[model samples]
Target: MSDIFEYAPAPESRDVVDIRPSYGLFVNGEWIDSLGDERHKTLNPATEEALAEFSYATPADVDRAVDAARKAYDSVWGRMPGRERAKYLFRIARIVQERARELAVLESLDNGKPIRESRDVDLPLVAAHFFYYAGWADKLRHAGLGEDPRPLGVAAQIIPWNFPLLMLAWKIAPALACGNTVVLKPAETTPLTALAFAEICRQADLPPGVVNIVTGAGETGQALAGHEGVDKVAFTGSTEVGRLIARSVAGTRKKLTLELGGKAANIVFDDAALDQAVEGIVNGIFFNQGHVCCAGSRLLVQESVEDELLAALKRRLATLRLGDPLDKNTDIGAVNSAAQLDRIRELSDAGEAEGAQRWSPPCALPDKGFWFPPTLFTGVAQSHRIAREEIFGPVLSVLTFRTPAEAVEKANNTPYGLSAGVWTEKGSRILWMADRLRAGVVWANTFNKFDPTSPFGGYKESGYGREGGRHGLEAYLDV
Candidate 1:
């Protein structure tokens, strides 16, 4: 809640999306009622308003979707040449670009992320994943995977709610490009954009059953991931759920890839530009309200400049805006849901109980929906729960290190190794730290930077397999 930069309430219009009272499951390329009676309403976490009710997919519904995907794989997608499949992926990407504003607005309303992020970050990245994969569809042979890499029959893809459409594109684009049919399940809280994407699949005249979306909670995802018919399973969410999915697919022919949780360390040395490092620190843990799986939640500053860096970081965080997600001026928005908010609060409170000093800027929060002020914890130790765990919110835990050796040791101490950041002016120092760091992705002067062409995933408990670049095609293809 930063009041340093005050602006008018420039809220983005939500009329771009036509929300239906109820949404049926998207299976076999069409909307259909779920066989089960379970129903849940998707909410606008910013206002706690009901956006729409969505049917939860039963085991039977999962079977129907798996059957459709299998049918499409055998009859259409699998047999089609990569070049022919590329055309469909291209169409989807183009349509997403054309409807970018609508999707951005809908994304903000449903996911409670700032409209600026949904529009500039999420929507563009969503389209980029498709566009990037569309170009790769006809070039898989040159991808160095294999001469004739074949699609892995049916793919069961379950994406997280934080970046719904983007994660959908991350899973679906590469799967389709590699000649596989997919049965996707968007996260329960943010299903509107994925449902809209099902319409986009229709608009592209994609063959029936080629791309299917079944919306529900964990149970529906469980049914789909555990189904016997799917040849590939891809998921992006919590580490605990990733473990369950990994176990479910074990001892089976199903190929699996998981992008799970992280407690990334953003290291800043004394030689780093203080002003630049401050901004990077803010972007590292505060981006997406720190809902990112690979967020740099642990700040490992050089002991020499810890005081200077902390002061600058605190000042920058105080200028960040927090309020209505639809407001074009807002920086931080609502937490995704009450459950996630509770988790953030529980962990943050534990940080205090464990003796870490907590600080927040003076700002009034809206009373309507889920909200947490951007928080900072100093005097943090590696053993502290806040430093060890993934808070997955706008909370930063600061810890200092003495040397390069100590920095690497501290950064790699966590069970998660999704990403890490190094902020030093020396190129040699950056290269030195990057080589020693255990993280899958290492940023030198930046934080939270993503590109469609770069391969990304993590080591150990953070999950396995890459999700972008030529390496991404490997997950959906059989070598």
Candidate 2:
């Protein structure tokens, strides 16, 4: 009775969102049909209901988009004053803020993340990203690149489904602010927000072909990335795909930036605040259902306090509510797709088969849509598959270390260097670990916090090139 009383269905009203039956591709500032007859259905991952059908971009469609972008770059946007360009971005940001509720509700409906997260985390950040980059539009001359850095002619950007709007903002905002026209391909599963963003672009009265969205799966991305007219290629997706893009553009004049996967380690020392550390651990791997590229999937704890930390973590996990994504109180939501859910299961099963002990809190999952429980595997070795691979799900692998040196060694053992977290009472030790950790973003006593002004990316296999701040502008500029 108490458990039932703890959470009641407080679902957000879906009436706020008005989804269309079919959405055409947004190219050259117009809603145009794809050249291909093939159409993909976008479904609600939480309900497995069809949200909308989107046409897949063919090679010809990609060519058309590139041509439009090139025309815009050569004729209008490329020659526009920086201050004028700034106004367009500012308008888009204001429109995003104005339509925040609709976008948030639609995002949750389409992406299967909790409404609270879509509304509170993704939507706000999307708007903030545009606002942040808008200010940089006119200030590019002072960005320290050189005197009067010029825009790369056109950027072909490919983003994944986990963060549709936010990733779009990250890629498109900086490129547009730098005066580059864009041909962007949104992931097939989450193209609605990108198309809606296209509408926002129209509302801003952005120059035609300045920002075009070509929707499709991997093939469309390949067509866009390999397109000869593109001057730059920026991608945020799997490392496998990123490597493919890198190879596709080899010897070409295209400037490339790839933000790929991560297997971050969250280290908690014995002297740290135990309760707060537990919360950070929860937020690290479970936030966004652990779909984050920089998710702290690896937990490295000082052996002396491992027992206490695990106990507290399990207690906290038990209280997490999992249900309808639109439910305001739901903490965990559906996995983004059935394919992603399968990947999470396969990796987790490998953990158990490889001698790690798997545990999940007792919770009933919805029967209708894709779902995965918040899971943890203890007694994991460095050699375990779960420890090394990017599961990209709500799963964590715990490893214990006796010394700070051992902790650092275990943390840096992975090929990915995207993000890491360190928790300790001693400030000096935090600095030491942070300095040694090879990841791009290091959070001390915190996890999964983001800001538009901060640079975010990875080192090594996690991929090169930062995505935010002034460093992001370098990718789109010709210095």
Estimate the TM-score of every prediction. Answer: 0.98, 0.99
Q: What shift in Å separates residue 399 of candidate 1 from its native position after superposition?
A: 0.3
TM-score of 2: 0.99
Q: Please give me the total number of clashing residue pairs in predicted model 1.
A: 0
- lDDT scores in order: 0.93, 0.95
Quote the lDDT for 399 in model 2.
Answer: 97
Summed backbone clashes in each candidate are: 0, 0
lDDT tens readout by residue for model 2, 364-458: 99889999999999999999999999999999999999999999999999999999999999999999998899999999999999999999999
Instruction: Tell me the tens digit of each residue's lDDT in model 1 across 1-479.
Output: 97655587998887888989999988888899999999999999999999999999899999999999989889989999888998999899999999999999999999999999999999889889999999999998899998888888999999999999999999999999999999999999999999999999999999999999898889999999999999999999999999999999999999999999999999999999989988898988888899999898999999999988888887888788999999999999999999999999999999999999999987689999999999999999889999998889999999999999999999999999899999999999999999999999999999988999999999999999999998999999889
Worst 10 residues of 2 by lDDT: 1-10
